[model samples]
Target: MTRSEATASTTGTPEADEYDVIVIGAGPVGENVAERAHANGLSAVVVETELVGGECSYWACMPSKALLRPMAALADARRVEGASQAVRGSLDADAVLARRTAFTSDWQDGGQVDWLDSVAVDLRRGRARLDGPRRVKIEAPDGSTHTLTARHAVAVCTGSRAALPDLPGIEEARPWTSREATASKEVPGRLAVVGGGVVGAEMAVAWRALGAEVTMLVRGERLLPRMEPFAGELVAEALTEAGAEVRTGVSVESLRRPSTDRPVTLALSDGGQLEADEVLFATGRRPRTEDLGLETVGCEPGSWLTVDDTCRVKDVHGGWLYAVGDANGRALLTHQGKYQARIAGAAIGARAAGVPLLETDRWGAHAATADHEAVPQVVFTDPEAASVGLTAEDAERRGLRVRAVDLEMGEVAGAALYADGYRGRARMVVDLDREVLVGVTFVGPGVSELLHSATVAVAGEVPVERLWHAVPSYPTISEVWLRLLETYRG
Candidate 1:
């Protein structure tokens, strides 16, 4: 009679034993795909090796952001309570790790399995490997083998895995990647970061704030090369202020164990070397598509499965297979992966149910999407940096009419009130022809919270004129938006 009652299905119970759709990798995207498929009246089963929620829920974004969030919360507390005794304290490593463990459900898979059962999506606990078209072979933890045949389609949502660089003895170093780095309990006395990308920069700041002497060896010119130059400059300033020694335009020549008790020494391409108790290789990641029996499916080694604009995995023999998320290399982000999964799920359901699926020329339901146009990104370092869409340099290379506006963040009222000695920058790129917001970069303390506002404006294609009307509150860091618009007009 009610929506809740209607959703309460037999599929969740053991009564609904067989499933029409079997999803490999029960990460967030996998769950999303399963849910979407279920909504389309197909029985869905989600197989997961670990927790149901995946990396963002436990290790990657959640834990990293959790460690960084205390600083943010403390800032808020200090701002609200001038007396300071109301929230007088520092981080307790044990307590934080305990909380993280609780959030991750303590590496136990039963709760997630129960959730899948309640949601009417079958939960299979196993390491899933793709066997062939519309098929998966799973090795359950209980020493049992099972096979699942997906009649509709198979969706791959295996998130990316850490990639170690080719440095002599680097592999032998037994260093921490994002997995160990984010889930670490104790902060090392000295930490050396090997990459300059998002994870490296963010973790460097987080650990440094937690009292680790951090030095970042980046092979790029700026801290976050993916952001605007102005934004990157602000992030670099933030890292330096927090006492992080960032050396750019350098590569790792060699890594070696100095002693059994001491830290490792990393030799650089610039004929310099540094030692730290901990070494983190955040160079990059590749799709976790290896050993999934893709060879049996005839997929290439070098590249990911070839999926169409609709997320239909292409092949010479046939075109029934599909891949999404990190496996597609479309966007190795949780949200983007989930977005692709939704499209793939909907497409499969529509085709199976013989419904004429509505298609769009660009972003909308039923498109693989996220190619072309803008995708928002944020680096959660102190004096944070956030950006969406193409920078002026990228736009020029792509042959777009771009007009850029740059301003020191200190010029805004928000920056002044944020702190007496504020340090950061704000920049925006506008499409001169379309008069729409293309990209925005906000850098400075307490600015990571401001990203979604700009993201909404850009994704909605809010015109610069309309954006001007969308007023940011006064005496807040967001007032930088007004200053930016004024600069653009002038």
Candidate 2:
């Protein structure tokens, strides 16, 4: 059926209404789950307390990318001599912020609500919790409570929240989390970022370009440590060149603020004091499973839920409770969460209809097999870092017979012409026994788009010999694939 046909028609009393499927958390993941369940001829309803699109639509991905894109564009222009000559002055912070506001629709959920209505999935604007098996209780905005029942399944898609480190006075310091960092209207004169992961790295690059003296304190040895060593090396070089002071092996001993208007004082592990107009903690994320009433079903609260290939919560009788997205902790990425939602919805439909699952093998419609075998990510910094599947370190740790091939992206003609003195690197981890690419990493300007190609290779498990026939266009950065295959052959 068409999406518009799915808009819920009427509202009945909560006590009288029962659906085939009930989804918690109206984020992208939950929306997809409801749509998929509806497609399988099951009635569905979605519950959300925040905006329908969740963190990604209002705060995380959309606003963060909107804030970073202008800085990246300016940097790209300044790299070429011809373009560099015409470019002048720092970015207009007000304009960039205005664009971000527009991208977020001024924190409104009208568009998302309309989309849900178009899809025919019922939307309940409230916070929801599991009351018991297939039963949910929602606390509405007006202080009224309503209960919902699911005839077939109840899916949890609450996603996750930014985790802050424990420190004295951290609560009183009024430090910025990712929500504040991405949505702030004004850029601080001096910004200090904690942690060296994707959010920290991208915000440093963005704020530094917007005229903030950014100081990035990483507790680890380098930035992007989860990727190849060279990825962090290239990103650090670029961030330093862009005027961000990146400190590695650093720790925050204490945090203090005399007044809300005053700068934050940070005591370092090395017995030094640092101060900044604003401090951001991009440390990590914790699943949003707490207080979801998991304890009602003999599961632990405030802990990640475990699920099977079909996303059914393990050890639960009858296989009716399902968890997807960050709540499951299989893969934290939004796209991967959506993939799990699709598989879970199909499994629910099959069971409801008493139709046995046709296939549970790899890449099956009822299994989230890709979460383990292939997961792609892109860090949208000035020099973008993109990768898919296993890294060389991961392959080695897993005892796989693998070889890592590295290439300087400056060797590619398109990269050379893309910027003057372009600097970047590419690496491919090849499985010796299978003769197929197990992983790929690209670090350079304009490398974000190259990630999908690598994802296809790893996900498809296409043999290296067969990859030769799929030639990349000449004078393109993608030619690095040919170079990588050639190096592997030798």
Give candidate 2 regions above 4 Å deviation: 1-16
Instruction: Give per-residue CA lDDT, model 1, range 1-490, as digits (tens).
Output: 3221232234533443335677878888888888888988887877777777787777788788877776656645555435355876666666666676676666665665565666667667778887777778889887787777776777777777888877788767888899888888788999999888899988897888778899999898887777787766766776887688988899889889956677899888999889899999998888877867777778865366667767777763555567777778777777778778888888879887987767845776788555545677778877678877778888888787989888888788777777656767777888899998777888877887788888787777888988789788887888888888898889
Candidate with maximal lDDT: 2
Residue-level lDDT of model 2, residues 1-490, one tens digit each, is 3332232324323444588899999898999998899888888899898898998899888999999999889989999999999998989999999999999999998888888887778888778989989899989888888788889999999999999999997998898989999999998999999999999998998888888999999999999988899988889999998889999999898899999899999998878888999999999999998888888888899888899999999998878999999999988888899989899989999999999988678888788888987899899998999999999999999999999999999998889999889999999999999999889999999999999999999999999999999999988999999999888888
Best by TM-score: 2
Q: Cα lDDT of model 1 overall?
A: 0.77
Candidate 1 global TM-score: 0.90
| Residue 323 error, candidate 2, Å | 1.0
Q: Assess each prediction's global lDDT (C-alpha) against the native.
A: 0.77, 0.89
Listed in order, each prediction's TM-score against the native is 0.90, 0.97
RMSD value for candidate 1: 3.9
